[model samples]
Target: MQLNWDSTEELRQAIHTYIDFYNNHRIKMGLKRQLWNIVL
Candidate 1:
């Protein structure tokens, strides 16, 4: 895939947008959630 950006801001925005989508929207199968909260 070829990405065309007009400026530096556009490039940063594009990268951040992709990261947000990957972390929040996309689901990872077999990803375990840590449920224990222990204070040392």
Candidate 2:
């Protein structure tokens, strides 16, 4: 995806947002052997 960020601050914010998602809200796997399915 192309981010139409017009300034350095916008790019910084986008990177920070992605970092927060990577740390918190994305996904996880347990020892029970569960799988994730993506539905379009």
Candidate 3:
């Protein structure tokens, strides 16, 4: 995928947002095993 950003800061922020959503909202069966390790 190609990300077109006007500045480095914008690209960084977008990447951070994507990572945050992937970790919190994306689910996997193995996630249950580590449920206690996640705070939210």
After the best TM-score superposition of candidate 3, give how far the Cα of residue 25 lies from its true spot, in angstroms.
1.8
Looking at model 2, report the run of 10 residues with the lowest lDDT sum: 31-40
Could you say which candidate leads in lDDT?
3
Clashing pairs in 2: none
Q: Could you give me the TM-score of model 2 versus the true structure?
A: 0.52
Looking at model 3, which ten-residue stretch has the lowest summed lDDT? 25-34
Model 1 residue runs over 4 Å out of place are 26-40
RMSD of 1: 6.6
lDDT of 1 by residue, 1-40 (tens): 9878899999999899999888875454213332222321
lDDT computed for candidate 1: 0.69
CA RMSD, predictions in order: 6.6, 7.6, 6.6
Give the clashing pairs for model 3.
none
| Ranking, TM-score, top scorer first | 3, 1, 2
Model 3, span 1-40: residue lDDT tens = 9768999999899899999888776566458757856855
TM-score of 3: 0.54
How many angstroms is residue 4 displaced in model 1 relative to the true structure, after the best TM-score fit?
Answer: 1.7
Question: Number of the top candidate by TM-score?
Answer: 3
1 against 3, candidate with superior lDDT:
3
Candidates' TM-scores? 0.54, 0.52, 0.54
Give the distance in Å from residue 5's predicted Cα in candidate 1 to where it truly belongs. 0.9
